[model samples]
Target: MTMPEQITPTGDMTVQTENLCAIFGGCAKCPGHAKAIDCGLVHLNPDALVFCIHGCHQLRVREKA
Candidate 1:
């Protein structure tokens, strides 16, 4: 995978502005899949990072306090 040029930190999370197609297993076989990929934002949380913009997949993160 190609690394993003810049990764900005947003509060307790960090984000990289790049195309995450490879990680998300390409675009979904749907009408709006293209649009969703184009407008999607790759978010990295404490536990996992997801490349979903249309809520296709649900990612849960549990932080141990």
Candidate 2:
């Protein structure tokens, strides 16, 4: 699937926020970062902590060092 544009007429910024997660150096380093869909979402009353289906499928909590 093609990467969704950050700005859309829909006015949803979820995708843009998701990209930030990738830039955190975690998903950004992942093989699917470039093609990630429904990734990290940040907004009040969010539908879910992880909106990305692919990300959820492969979700793993990082253990504190």
Candidate 3:
């Protein structure tokens, strides 16, 4: 996957200002798919540093390897 160019830090996970966003709860397109579509997100936490303007349910965390 292509990472966003402008990523803003939110605690640990970086949010993409361009079009990336957290797909909370789940994606309606298929079963449990975390995707970035149409420059929007679903059921995202309001407090999340990197999130879509729409908002989603399931929260994803990133760990450096």
TM-score winner: 1
> Tens digit of lDDT per residue, candidate 1, span 2-62?
4343335444453222244443455564232222224333334332332334344445789
Q: Give the TM-score of candidate 1.
A: 0.25
For each candidate in the order shown, give its overall lDDT on alpha carbons.
0.38, 0.37, 0.36
lDDT agreement of model 2 with the native: 0.37
Tell me the deviation in Å of residue 11 in model 2: 1.7
Model 3 misplaced regions, further than 4 Å: 8-18, 21-48, 53-65
Q: lDDT tens digits, residues 1-65, model 3?
A: 33443334444442333223232322343233223333333324323334344334346688889
lDDT of 3: 0.36
**1-65 per-residue lDDT for model 2 (tens digits):** 23344323224433322433343345444444322233332243234222223463365889999
Model 2's number of clashes is 1
Model 3 Cα shift for residue 3 (angstroms): 1.0
Clashing pairs in 2: 38-52
Kindly give the stretch of ten consecutive residues in candidate 3 with the minimal lDDT sum.
Answer: 17-26
Error of 3 at 4 (Å): 1.6
